[model samples]
Target: MSSTLSRVRAAYARVEAVGRPEIWIDLRPREETEAEARAIDERVAAGERLPLAGRLFAAKGNIDVRGLPTTAGCPAYAYEPAADAPVVARLRAAGALVLGTTNLDQFATGLVGTRSPYGAVRNAIDPSRISGGSSSGSAVAVALGIVDFALGTDTAGSGRIPAAFNGIVGLKPTRGLVPTAGVVPACASIDCVTVFARTLAEAEQALSHAAAGPEHALPPLPRRRPGPWRVAVPPIGQLGELDEGWVAAYEAAVARLTAAGASVRTLDLTPFTEAAAMLYEGAFVAERYTAVGPFVDKLISSGGEGLDPTVAGIITRARDIPAHRLFADQERLADLRARALAELSDADALLLPTAPGHPTLAEVAADPLGANARLGRFTNSTNLFDLAAVAVPAGEVNGLPFGVMLIGPAFTDERLAAIARSLEPRVRLAVLGAHLTGQPLNSQLLAQGAVLDGTTTTAPAYRFHALRTDPPKPGLVHVGGGGAAIETEVWTLPAEGLGRLLASLPRPMTLGTVELADGTTAAGFLCEPDALTDAEDITRYGGWRAFLAGAEDSAPSGVRGTARSAPTHPHAPLGDHPTDE
Candidate 1:
């Protein structure tokens, strides 16, 4: 066998031996695979090296791959395509070989993997849990090391949620970053082609290749920026409902950032959550019907029987929405886009949980729609606001993997990726409040490559303050010797990543010594004293999260607090471009 074929076979063998999660469908025949590899061998022999030489990849069955049948999860919906999708053609031309088409939720409707007629994709790390979906097979394929990367689509977090569950990197680029010319429509205006891989570098590489060039031709170079980074995270209380395991995981990630020297601060996520709810609960749902309603209705009329009941039900509901309602949803989405940009205005990127929680397969089966909605809680708003996102595994929770997502405005794919590469290795971190793992900003840490260490407490002498910003900001200050030990955690990061992280800090927020109860100092977030004059001291509750919980019942208006006057502290400077070192 040729070298490329042998490598692909070996990788496939490993996956088969381990009985890895569902990863392939409609695989290329061995002869075809061999012939493709031989073509690459010939090119190399001719001294023509391709950017993705001999790499193996997979495509979600919904995307067209020339000569392959595109089954969008329904046998009746299958069709043979004569041409490759623009993105697929780009990858193939770069010397990548297609291994097979991966499975997904029927028509890419659900986040839980069970909706597929092809059998539910099990979590790569645990068989009992559900792999996040509709990119289920794509995520598992990479997590199992069966392929270098895979293509999936994200209309409402199908691409990202699965990546979080499978312990891999899932890149959901800005809506149009990668051409969707050949992809089956889910919600045409918001659909995005996504990439999945074992590492951020690999996923980013694939994303850059797919998104290269002008709107039509593949560009010669990838848009990349290097150096210091500023990442905004959701303040406490705004993190949404999260299980304890996720909370611990998130806190640990934040601590890792402090140790790495990257500044982690809280921002308001109200606008994001507001926007996210609109995707499914508002007129956006009708877009799905607009794309395939006729086909579905025809199938129903013809007595066709393969459609997933849930998917059919969702599409049928879309028909109930009126034209005016659709227009109103569009206007609301526009308003949210403006608000989201303002909320995320200061930082280089926004960090949040990839999902609020991980439910078991049984739990999902019992309440598929509800469970699926929860999985997309943090992801749905991304495409609506035209943001780029990357979901990376944070660590495990009770033997199941946990993940976080990093989000940035349109075309900020490279910037979010650079930050994810830095955070990947630092799994364990300690946080005192709302930014904990599984929390809103936890995704920020996960995207940066952090893993959860564990949960603990801090020494009593320090005080935690909640700054009055829209989403809320936290300031940890070292008080004189009389304080009580506060609860905390510790996360570890690669030594090389810390420097790049430290340089991204905004003013007033600085990395400094945080005394633990054991007389040990760990890297934790601290702010300048001058900035705390108007801040609310919530040290008695020990963390910003606890304070927010108590105040939740009496929560003030969404527009209650004024944005803090541009930071006066010299240490936490902002405005450094991602392209600047």
Candidate 2:
């Protein structure tokens, strides 16, 4: 959408109306913004289908944009990048113009939006409240609608927490899905280029375009399949203390999900919380030292001001971590990662408040480290565990915004995107046999943008047979009275994804309406009666997994089976049943 030079002028007018220069460390002149907008219009006229054409976005100071010094919210460390970060280049190419580089916590440390020397990024709705950082300015820019969306980095909840505080959508893609080629590394190993948008679709589109570029150390993302979305919530006891208003809002949020045909399950918060602690309390702090230690040392030795005291202290202490301690922490992290995957194996995603609560600027100043650590309670484990997360606004609490985050194992980015979409269009599908989590064919479902909603069973009206296929498959046939309830998982996908999934299905397997244990019916897998003629009746095992476990027991230890007992990664130490971890 463009209006010659008029629309760009209007956008700048809105920028001035908000009048929060402190929110941005380096905002381009109105003339420059207009020029860029006009340029985008010219490109559109040239028939470019730039998904982000005519849109304005802000980049976190940590991310490079040519012509502007990347301050990373630290003036002492500012430097002009030779070119835009790959992610930014992709967005700009897609027709989105940059408004300016926004502020952040110095060196991308601290979750409090207040750590920046440019000035503490005030909350958009209430200036006295914290904006949530280190993506503070980027989130506020979108929160105030100053920009259509913004690019933020998520090392330890910098992206999602800010979105929660500002009441917007923050999509933190699978760790390496979005290129971080030009981002200032907070923790290079886990730093991710994240997107903040007024809507989930906007963020998803930006993600799609940005992730298409070449990347370094790209990791595999799980292909998701469709079914009922099962969301896991931490028990009240694990949520820790929050204001009465926030607690009420959280409960209401869960109730809303439950009422929306979603099955909400309780999860043990121990593993997640423990892993989160590792981000700062464990050897992971060494990562921060590795990223900025040289600069910090130079600053100190040269008599220049160093990082915000708290951040400086954290990195400084990292030097004391012995080599063996780093190895020990890695081992600890491996165990935690496995346990986390096991915890999430049964459900489509984990749902939690984006942050424990919103702290006031005054509160953060008084206890920066403590307050900031609380903000990352739900987000710190995401990157460490290599998962995808999206933060969605839920409602307000005591006049400040509250939000919930949906987190899933890696490669669930698209599925999480669909789930986070407002009024999302989707179709529910029940999946039995190989498409289940950790199964060999599960990728087929994921490739079609399917998400595992949750585990369930067919209403004692279906019989399962082990077919004699080369790779092994299950055949489910509806039986009148002698059938048994068979374990199955429900997955959900975009309506369009269903066709792709069906097209990929081989013969003997077809889509059919199946009754679930919950009295609901969904399009699911079914087999032609004739296909079961020579198949073995495995219905007595109740589910494909049970049969696999039985087969494994009869076979020698360490012998592999059709179903994966655990993820292939060495970090995952799960058993045959992922949920059993």
Candidate 3:
């Protein structure tokens, strides 16, 4: 209970600190939100196992929240919703409280976040840059840590672009998969509700809850085909005019994926890009006019009081797309979709840059339409072809954030998510003792799904000792000058697994950063000064494995005492030590 309240209080504090009021269209009263968090705490105290217990989240303004006006980023379009949108309701039922409604592009029309009459949602990382939109507010809120996650609507990369620009995870489920019953649609048939979170796990967690309840629009969850991972990427020539930084970041991501055991394949991405272009350029855009044209018409009739000129121009003009053009475009889309999906047929997913570039606010101001269209170059095709995607932060391109998307067939959300998880940042742990490969404690790492990274020796700045404990262990302590280069093994695993291991590790030891002889540093085990009082200094042996070999040769066969103990972390992988065995 206290945890929930503390988090809520901290969230409110963050909101106040962010200094960006345009990120929200309506921020709920702090006290009211706290009260709700407290109530959730009480429910948990009663032995409930709510998945989203005590979680605080935000909803995009286009998503209806009871008592909050749905502005869709234009104040004149605002109206109080009588009830929560199904997605919001589902999250609330799972014990999450909606912190507020966030800002977006007007009528969810623009991809540059500047279309809102309220104000543009600035990039959380660099205020000078534009935050990708129309899911602007939701992405910024999550990026700033003001909320655990936020709900957004995506038709043409609104969900992904902001997330990429903000350096967060954006998970957009298959089109119409999560019910859109209460959302103010930009293109009703193609609009998808999405989740923005700091990590893939958290984003997926929110999605698990949001995808439940009444009026879901999809087939049952898909059973992924069993095989080695084969991910498709665009051919080098197809990359066009990307900057060196973007190209490098993307190649680095592929390298990381390869290291994580995925085979990479190249596929021509023209069909996908063409279909993406059609979402806004073809007669398909007429769907947006059908959604809010009448309201725009009424507003224009009333002296054009509150329309954003760019958004108005897009939607109003969409109304005049000839009827035959609409059918022709549909036929065109069908052929394109077939070609695109066919290329993806033999692969697990198609990986691509989340956006062509991250534009600064000034750059966007100079060419709003062109900049936004460019942002959608890698994104706009998903909904047009009923695909599922998960956008992940790959690395930085120069100083700005760069992201990549893993797109797969519709209903393959979970599969794409699993592949994306492999590409997420990982932790490399160095161990000088017990947890090494072939040791009794090595099973801990294996159990946690950790894989052996490699072996390396520490920098000559540590003293190694064999501790006197039930499970004889070796400890390495940084000694600055008199230390020797100690050998260690490195293992890599998910950050979550490392956390679980850290929590279960026993005392007198720690998982601290260790400098390797190769000039790299990694999380490694170290012991406290006091714990080494009566321990044997084995630095001369260079490593625990060497010491163990010497002891076996010198001691009698029966002298080896068996006193095995648990590994440092519950879920960990480690290296050799001076064990009696």
Candidate 4:
């Protein structure tokens, strides 16, 4: 068996060995999972490039994965979708295999995992603690190493809190970036599909595939360059009810950020906290009522109540809220969004604890609503303001995990990923040809959210050629000897972004590790040996730009193909995805 298939088999074996029924509402059969692994190996052997090849993944019960019933954590409300949710389909297309459908809080109404009838998902590290939810099962699966990453829905703190509790990475992208087509909505308009993984790169790898739908219209945000960034923190007086352990952990995290050159400053958090209150205490609760209200009403009428009392109570109350009150709440939310954005104006991101505390299952059982509300103190405001956020493990407090989230403006998903990676580990890559700055295809780099680190030359081991194509691309072929240093640009892109870029490249080009002049190795663009046939040797020109300049100044010489007509960019903001453009 191939190494990837072997690794997958071991992972599945470990998951089976755990016997944690609460962690999954419905799991794909072990035989089926292994069969898919074998298929992936076959495809890889056949030379197909799958970005997430052999990676195991799970989906929240709310997200439709073909052959599984989507219950949204309420079994009575289950429905079998004909196909996977758009997000899940994207992950599968990129080579990830689904292991199962995980449990969640019923109707995605509660933050504590105990609200589910399937049973509270136990904390991965400490079984006595509440596994944060409604994406509880998804987070736990990732935390337990059963899956590389999982999909969750985030409205309120459904996505972030679970990651915080599980000591994993939670990436809730900007609202509307990932299409919600096949997801059971919590608050349809505000719900965002989220990613949970053991590392930022894993979450980002899934996000890069899932974020942009075929019809996304927003322009790609500029890459966030690494440096001493402005990070906003809430004033000490505003921190509520956090135990000493959590407070110490939070403070130490800030110190680390400061030591790492971040300009950590205190900002008034009143607006943010107030906005969070609007999610439950204000009229915005009506949106939740609208999402599953009919089904809820049917269950009640049929005398088949599957929802937890707390969840049912929360959604039922929305019926009493007047329409004008919801409108008034929306207007109030607009004002709060402005105020919150103002506080973040001078900062690249707002840094806040993902949750004030991690409650035990018994504690949650005693006071579900109160404990859940406390968890949202730092998270509920994000979606209301249409911002992006990444929750990462800060450190453990008294054996329990604590996490912090970095919030940025809408479309700043890539930027948040950058900041998240800076706090963890990352990969660096090299690029030439179309991705160079000011080139026709340079937007692809920005689309992938890569930052230019610096320019350097290869270690005198490659020959450059101008490929005979409509766009007049360049190709670098590594030669054993008699090669010259080739000019190239190095970028620190997320590993997932690099995968997407690799998958999108046309035939005759590939991504391979290249040696830089500084004696360092990085993933860089390369060409198939056969591509050099009938191609113009541009090694003497030094780089793509120089060759292009020479071509522009002089007549088309032998093998120097003329450039084709440039296409108009109507959706320059939407990025280079052929499906969208």
lDDT (Cα atoms) of all candidates against the true structure = 0.74, 0.78, 0.82, 0.80
TM-score of model 1 (CA atoms): 0.71
Off by over 4 Å in 4: 212-214, 217-227, 425-581
Error of 3 at 403 (Å): 0.5
Off by over 4 Å in 2: 1-4, 214-227, 422-581
Best by lDDT: 3
lDDT of 2 by residue, 219-247 (tens): 55555466667888888989888766888
Tens digit of per-residue lDDT, candidate 4, span 246-328: 88888887887787678888888999999998899999899888898877877878885677778888888887899899889
TM-score of each: 0.71, 0.71, 0.78, 0.74
Mind giving the per-residue lDDT tens digits that candidate 1 earns over 298-350?
Answer: 98888858888888888888988999998998898899889889977767778
Residue-pair clashes per candidate: 41, 17, 7, 1
Clashing pairs in 4: 219-573
Give lDDT: candidate 4, residue 18.
79
TM-score result, candidate 4: 0.74
Give the better candidate number (1 or 4) by lDDT. 4
